[model samples]
Target: MATTSGGDLSHFAISSVYGELLSEMSILTAVETGLLEFVCCLADGLAPQAKGHFFGSRNLGASGDTMRATIVLVDDISRQLGVGFSWKNENFAFLEKVAAW
Candidate 1:
C-alpha cells in the first residue's frame, strides 16, 4: 500500500434498483484508456486504488466496444409487494478495460 498527503485514486459510488449503472463513466473511461490495469475494491463500492483507474480531471475522447467491469459491493434485493418482481439497491466499483488479454 502507498500513502501520500493527497494521494491519487478515484472514489465514490451510486446505488440503483435495476439495470447497469455508473455515476460517471467518462473518468473511468479515461483511466481505462490510460496506463492502468486493475482496481482495488471495497464492500460498498468505495475504493482506495484503481490500477487502470483515475482520480482527477482528464481530457478523453470517445470509447467504443470495450470491456467494462462493475465491482458490486452491496446488493439488497426485495420482492415487490404482491408482484412477481423484485427491487434492489446496488453499488459497484467500476473498471474499464484498456487492453485485451
Candidate 2:
C-alpha cells in the first residue's frame, strides 16, 4: 500500500465528513430550499480560494454546499441556546468583538 502523507489524511477526513453530511440530505422541498439558501449565505462570506474541497476554511461559505449542512447544525445549537450569530469581515472591530466574547 502507498504511504499517505499528513496532508492526504487531512483531506480524506474532511471529504469523508462532507460526503456523510450530503448523503443525509432528503428531497423535501422545504429542507432542500433552506439548505440552498444557507449555502449561498455561507458562500457570500468565504474568500474565493477557501471555496475548495480541502486545505481551506471549513466554516460556512468556504466549501461547496457543505456549508449548508454546517450552518444548519450551527443554527440548531445557537437557537436552542438562545444566542445570536453574526459574521463580520476580518477587521479590527470583528477581532474586538470576538475578544470581548
Candidate 3:
C-alpha cells in the first residue's frame, strides 16, 4: 500500500490485489467520537482479525533555528484504505477494491 501524507488525514492506495468490494469502512465513522458505530462488513463477517488501539492526536513543537514541528490529527478516513483500526478490541475492517496484492 502506498500512503501519502500531506497535512491532515493522509491518503492510502492499495497497490495490490483486485477483487469485488465486499465491504469497506466508513470514512465518517469516528474512531473515537462514538457516533454511528459502523465497521467494515467484511471484518464483521470474517474472523482472525487483529487487535489494537486507534488514536488520533495532534501536537505542536518548534524545530531548530529554521525548522518547525507540526502534527495533524486525522479523525477521518479520507481515502478508502483504512478498514478498521481497533486491533486490541478485535474491531477491524478492510476494503478490497480494484487492487493487486
Candidate 4:
C-alpha cells in the first residue's frame, strides 16, 4: 500500500477492512454534512449493481486540527456501510483501496 503525509503529520490515513455485504443503499447514507455529504449524495444515486465507491475528505483546520477524529469517522462509516474502508493522502500517487486483509 502507498502512504503520504503533509507537513509533519498534517494528515494520515487509517483504514480497516470489513466483510462485504449486500449494499444496495448508499454506503454513506447517514452522513448529514461536510465534505462527505456530497460524496454520500452521489453514492446514494448510484445504480444498485455498482461494484464500488469512493469517499474522500480533507481538513484545512476548520474543526481545530482533528485529523485523527476524521479518520475515525471514516472508519465508523465503513462499519455502518458494511464495506472495507481505506484512505490516501492527497500527495500520494494513488489512493490505496483496501479490503479486509
Candidate 5:
C-alpha cells in the first residue's frame, strides 16, 4: 500500500468530504460512514484501502444489516462498472455470508 502524509491533497480532500458528510448530514453512524467509504475505495480499485475500511467498520460496530447493504451496494456498483474482483477469501467470510447474491 502507498503511504501519504497528513498534508497530502488527496488525504485532505477525503478527510474534508467525510468531515462535512458526517457532521452536516448527521444520518449515518461512524460504522456506516466507514462502509460507504469502503465502497468508494472498492470502486476506485483500492483494494487495500477497501479492506481497511471494511474491517474498520466492523471494528466500529457495524450491524449485520449495514454489512448486507454494503455487500449489495458493492455488488451492484461492481456489476454496473464491469469491475471484477474476489472477496471470497477467508478474510471476507463474514461479508460473504450476507452477500445479496
Candidate 6:
C-alpha cells in the first residue's frame, strides 16, 4: 500500500479547489485571482503560501505583464491602506524570471 505525504495531500487539496474555481472562470481571471491571493498572503506576512500562489499563478499562464501589474497594484493598495507591505523578498526573487518567461 502507498501513503500520501503531507505535502502531497496539501497539493491535492489546493488543486481540487483551484480546479473547481478555474472551471467557472476564464483562465485570465483565475490567474488574476491567484495573483491577488498571493498579494493578500504577503499583506498578512505569509511568505511561504504567497510564494506557492505566485508560482501557481504563473503556471496557470499569467503573463509577465499581468504579474508586473499585480505587483504595482498591490504596492499601491498597501500605500493607500497605510500598511508597510513589501513585495520585495528573497522568497520572491524568482518572480522576475517567472515574469520574463
**lDDT of every predicted structure (CA atoms):** 0.28, 0.42, 0.22, 0.34, 0.67, 0.72
Question: Which residue runs does candidate 6 get wrong by more than 4 Å?
Answer: 1-29
User: Please, what is the TM-score per model?
Assistant: 0.20, 0.26, 0.15, 0.27, 0.54, 0.63
Candidate 3 regions off by >4 Å?
Answer: 1-38, 41-43, 50-101
Reference-based lDDT, residue 1, model 4 = 25
What is candidate 5's CA lDDT for residue 21?
Answer: 59
Which model, 3 or 6, shows the larger TM-score?
6
Model 4 scores worst on lDDT over the 10 consecutive residues at 92-101
Better of 1 and 5 by TM-score: 5
Which digits, one per residue and each the tens of the lDDT, describe model 2 over residues 11-84? 76557744555445566333454445444444344433222322222332244444444556655666686655
Give lDDT: candidate 6, residue 8. 75
The residue pairs that clash in candidate 2, if any, are: 42-61, 43-61
Write candidate 4's Cα lDDT for 1-101 as tens digits.
Answer: 23244432332222222112212225543222333433343334332211122232222122322333443565577669976533332322122322211
Give lDDT tens digits, candidate 3, residues 1-101.
12345522322222221111212335432222221111232233322311111111111122221111111112134224464433323333321110221
Query: Highest lDDT: which candidate?
Result: 6
Q: Candidate 4 — which pairs collide?
A: none
Q: Give the count of colliding residue pairs in each prediction.
A: 2, 2, 13, 0, 0, 0
| Winner by lDDT between candidate 3 and candidate 2 | 2
By summed lDDT, which 10 consecutive residues of candidate 5 come out lowest? 92-101
lDDT of 1 at 47: 39
What value of lDDT does candidate 6 attain over all alpha carbons? Answer: 0.72
lDDT-sorted candidate list, best first = 6, 5, 2, 4, 1, 3
RMSD of every candidate to native, in Å, equals 14.7, 10.8, 17.3, 16.8, 5.1, 4.4
Better of 3 and 6 by lDDT: 6
